[model samples]
Target: MSSSEPDRAVPDPRRWKALALLCVAMFVVNLDAQIVLLAIPSIEQDLGFTSGSEQWVLSAYLLTFGGLLMLGGRMADLLGRRRMFFIGTTMFLLASVLCGLAWTGEVLIAARTLQGASAAVMAPTALSILVTTFDEGSERNKALGIWSGIAGFGATAALLVGGPINDLLGWEWIFFLNVPIALILLGLGPVLLRESRGERRNAFDIAGAITVTLALVLLVYAVVEAPDAGWLSAQTLGLIAASIVVFAIFAWVETRSAAPLVPLRIFRNGTLVGGNIVMLLLGMIGFGMGLLVSLYAQQVLGYSALIFGLGMAVMTVMTVFGSAVGQALVTRVGFKPVAAGAMTLLGIGCLLLSRISPDGSYLGDILIPLLVFGPGLGGCYVAATIASQTGVAADEAGLASGINSAGFQIGGALGVAICSTVAASVTGAATGTVAINDGFRAAFIACVVFAVLGLAVALLLRANRPAASPAAPAAEDVPAPRTGAPVHAQAGE
Candidate 1:
């Protein structure tokens, strides 16, 4: 067998089953994030949640999920990916059930937090499994394309489905829907998924994990609160300052720790760093657009939830299509152009969206951008994900996947906070339809800026052919000192 090939022969039936289960899991987790957006109004009405507290339902989940992702990946490595996967799936199912049964906003928020944490554990491990199960090259690309597609497409699909489901059934059913899917995946997991673990000797970096988690949580909290508290508020300043301190400590800990939770050396590679930068930017632009667009559709356009969902459906379909196409072409053309082109398209789409006015129609104004933006985002996602994991070793795949996923989740939180702040600031003192359009335009312009930045980062990636196998290290890798400095050591130095 080739070096990149799996040691064991392909278990055809089992592999297909495993892929199906993983896809279902991906769909459920993503659906949870977006479905709630459409149902938020209903949830508030039913649970009597205050306006300020309602955002926590989504924020709490994102906070815990994003905060613990590195740790979850580390746990998967130490404990075993399959074990962690099963545990995560079970926890997610239980949390979904609790969310469905939640009577108060507090309980729903808590359940969502649990759901997010469990999702963090599951998401990275799923990618790791795909890497291990499929041989590198076409097979792996196809699997990853599907995986990435599910994550993006699921969110948009949730919006489409959530409105109808909530209207026909109830807000509870939005979560209850996960129960059946989770059960199916749980049943298939043991039989289809093989047992896998990372390098056994590396110790888990508990201190590094804790510090990083605290840093991200504090940072996200500060940003999220800035809109309500004002930028100059002491509470916001204190949280932001504390986050900076914690992150500095995290960097220090990673450098010295024998088994760093995040190996600082990984960032030294231009490809990895550049890829993650683009991913972060793409996340900010893409997610921010989704939030603002949804708000505009309902608030300004005066569209029903169902109509709003339908209007966004084109973006979802195109995203899936683009992912499929990008996966097929990435090996042939390489990641640089694909990423750069995608960002360019995304920038154009956002600029077009910025042109929207009170007289704009869904088909003419929204649909055009959705079409362009979906494909652009899909290309960026595939290229960035592949680039991040390109040279990662088998044992380190889980950690690499975790870091990439973290960039995306953190980007969403950051984007939402920043975009919301900008929109609020622009529209705060204004009134009526003009104010709404101004807020939307401000957010879209921000998206355009983010997209352009992503394109610039993508251009920094070297024009090199992608490797045929996971075993082949990315061209970006170079031998260096443990301190991440380029050096040549003597035998006895």
Candidate 2:
């Protein structure tokens, strides 16, 4: 059988159990992204982080994680999904330990970089494994719904628990918490996951991988540091220019490589392209909103960290409910309509949140918007993901998974930078409560703009259609990666 074919005729019975394990793994990845936000002050005091440099603690992780995701995904496809996942989980565990044990700011930042690198390996590989595990129709859609909901919940859950954890324990426990979870994943993974990989090509795309990785790292670094460096400063402009040049070089390398890291023709899949666009907009809103809300609650409203987290608890609950509903709706209707509806809700939520007053209470201003927003967030994740994966070949599943993740992460960096810059512009050396609240309100309005753009893109997505079978084409008919149509990678034959 071709490597693109599913190895099993009947689905694995352990798939559901495996899905639970994968979700747990995904939870940790999502949690780490925002848990540190609440603990930044404690971490700074403890580690003696310089005023400006403390941001590196977060940037360090985001940089490496976003940079290497594509390489990580392709490696999983080439090396073995299960093997890469195990390696990533073990590495993450060690990095978490290192993070907990660090006495210096530099050491913690180094450990965070390691943590991000490992996450780069884990996220896409886990999703690729999921793509391979379930049947691609309603079964996969259902599993993705559960997965997307938990994934959304993981981010908010960090907000829910991060403050309490930091207040009761220390910031170290935030990293250390991954210890038991990682150990559990390491133990359960081997038994639960079946090994799988794509066909091994004769030559590895070393140039393509290196160039693309460098390009992504530079891109992330540019946006992340733009707010501090001054968006129009030479440093920011230089890095952005350099990133574009390197990306151009990577494209050139792909066209010439014997085995390109990302086959250029993958762009031919219109659904995948449209889905990623929407996902990018979603990412802009998701992380940006979290940061803005946290800032408004604690910095403006004068709520304690623990209290703020507790106030946001409804977001987590509603996101879970939304995921379940969105998944069910997608199965019945289609991803396009569901995605459009979700974006509409998100836009409405943002509009409501854009009107927050300086003296606003959580019950009066924040809670309603979160209630309106959470389901849309949950549903949009599922819809966009399903859309991105549609028509992708099983052999390229890891690559597609990586692209989907990269879209969100890179978009998050951009979103946060844009929102932060906008807020800073509005606040402009003003520390007053009204000034800060105005900044927060303006940021929410920015989020509303993202939602509207996302909705427009969602409308443009191709209708949901069954993917073509890879086996339909003879070996000789398979076109070269650079020049031909995609070889649809249906999960089960």
Candidate 3:
């Protein structure tokens, strides 16, 4: 038996209970994401944030979240998962406290930055613990399905609850609400979750960690600032150039390091790389749609922020619907076709929404596209996560999860920047509905391009997944690696 089989042999009955707690952690993170989104205008008014400075309130969190995720994932592997989870929650709670107490725009932005950093540590480790505890096959698959479904709810819960919370208790409650939940998790975590870590390696990859993290930060910052600063300006051009240099140095360090933070060899898996690529695009699609649609609804259609949140709830609900059916579709039709179809649906949905008019109502303009986008939105996330995690070894579970998570986090920053930049570029000397809708149309066109590219890449995931690995059992004749990454339906291959 392989080294990983022993972990499976001694099952932890408390694993399910642990999952419930982990889900709560995930729930709070997802909830926090949406709460502020709807409340941004209110937050800006209260804190005196100008429109230009206001974007930072959103981008700051994303910057830290994306930059630190790889490091966070590695830390989870080095430290214990339970320990990391606790630390993460505590930091998140403190950040929330600061955000609630914040009297200035600067403070609020800083608090949000800390919150993202905290979540970066907490988020991937939860899934690592799940993967470590559960065995592969229907059992692990089912757990992932449930996890995805809960994640969908966590993401959309803010839409359902955020509008009311912001209205009734004030915008501060969005952050304050996390206090009780975190304290409860802190109290119960030690008893509920098991401590798991990879074998301690000889030396920490300090150079590798620093360089890669710097590159990610630079990249994220470059995109975030490009819109306001002019994409071709020296500042934007220099930042992009520097990020490439720093990333190249990190790659060099990884190749030479005795123990790399990101294993250079892991990139050898085409499925892993492709899956992460698709994930990045998924990030663009998901975040881009949320921001653009919300803008059109409020600015063009004259809906209230609260009403818009509730309307967005419609999309979130559809996502849950898709995730529920995603696994079954993958099982029956295979990941490639399901994922391709899902992206196609997303593309078509974005294309349809680009037809919005000044006189359009929510039911007429927004509902159809959101409803069409819902299932694919729900299904693709789970599919991408599965595809990314397929061949990864037990030890690298956190790493895989972090990269997958980073794709979305970083994708958000890119999406906002790209959409904003594209939309803004066309608004010169133009005013009123024509200017704004012009930007929206241009941005949606970019989203459609991204969706199509993602669909094409999804096609590659099936072909690139190899038919054999040495560790794969000869008796069972699994086409993909049993211990490493595998095609979901490789049995037929």
Candidate 4:
């Protein structure tokens, strides 16, 4: 950077090691987001939480995580990626400790909110680091494939592990499990993670951040509680309307601010936008399906948490294969076809799942659809990871990554709300279990619709990378030997 400074002779071979460290953190965060599925009943009973308050344990985390991701990402760009990583990991660690020790439902909810905020900072920064470190061809593809594979399976891993941990110790152990992992990452992160930041700098858009956060909180709360509140009730409608108004204000603020939290120009890229939309669709179906299927397993089939986890694990193994194959195929056929075809397969899987009967066996009902959908979901994630990170400049890497990940987080909450509400829409005097079964079927039907819509969007997307200002293609740096031709677009196809 200076005349006296000598250029380094050796490339950093430790980059991949850093990625592995980042994945450790991400696994814990993603796991925390979903592992509570099995523990919810235990938590409600132990902490004396009402049904209403119990649901908030999950919603609060989603609200903060989805709402603050852009802000966290922008801060990472401004403050330095490594710095943000440490801070985020520390916050997450502290929150996990508190969650494990929580004596009240309110305290647990508060701790979860902090954990979500910490995840918001860490997850995008981790992705940005990977984007900046790896080239966009086979090398980047390989790394992203692994990263996407981890993401697609992290929740299932949690589900599988949650049962054993909860049964052996308690639900608190689920949160506590993050402690050692967090400390280890914090210890290694400074040494392993290289520092990078945007070439440009500007004042923090605090107003935009607050506006968007408030909007998201309102939106998430309204959606999560809408099933019980009556979706058409004035309370639900009012919150939804208010959230829209706040979001409009945030969008306006972004346009006017010299340093916007979310750069609107990124949306112009059809491939990236399509990737994000599909990511949202995945998020929606993923969380919603988990809730429905797990409920059906536990309530209807009387499966234990361990059984639920193991069932999902079978699917996770298939997911790994899907992602591995997807990474290979994207280099050959491009992300567009992989994304569309994979999403269509998932849609069909959802359709198949909708036919599940109350008396269905695991092999016929659960295993069939899980086998059908696992690889599809894995392929979708791999395609999305590549597409989302493909066209962005180094400076805006965190922002782009945040938005893509945000789609999943926000979509999950909205999906759960909608599906849960729909599933619960049975008439009076119906058995509770019957209502739940009906609800799951409805949720699967909704997933089918969303998956179909995602397939359409993916099919319509362009494969060429959108032009990014201030920097060149990320793939240009590595110069890996081309197998046949350049895989995805670089500024132009």
Positional deviation of 135 in candidate 3, in angstroms? 1.6
Clashing pairs in 3: 390-485, 391-484, 391-485
Winning model by lDDT: 2
Across 288-384, the per-residue lDDT of candidate 4 in tens digits comes to 7777788889987888887777778887887878889888888778888899888987888889888877787798788888887888988998898
Instruction: Supply candidate 3's per-residue lDDT for 231.
Output: 90
Per-candidate TM equals: 0.91, 0.93, 0.91, 0.91
Model 1 clash pairs are none
Off by more than 4 A, model 1: 1-13, 470-493
RMSD of each: 7.0, 4.8, 6.5, 6.3
Name the better of 1 and 2 by lDDT. 2
Model with the higher TM-score, candidate 2 or 4: 2
Q: Write the per-residue lDDT of candidate 1 for residues 1-493, one digit (tens) a residue.
A: 4432332333344566677778778777767766788788888999999868888878888887777777777777667777888899999999999999998999999999999999899888777776666656666667777777877787668778888888889989988998998888778777777666665544778899899889978887786677788778999999999999999999999999998878887677677777778878877887788888888888877887888887778998988888887777777788899899889989999899998887667987788999898888787888888788776666666777777777887788778877898888898888887798888899899998898888888988968856674452111123544655322111111
- Give the per-residue lDDT digits (tens) of candidate 3, residues 281-315: 98888788778887887787888777777777777
Model 1 TM-score relative to the real fold: 0.91
Candidate with best TM-score: 2
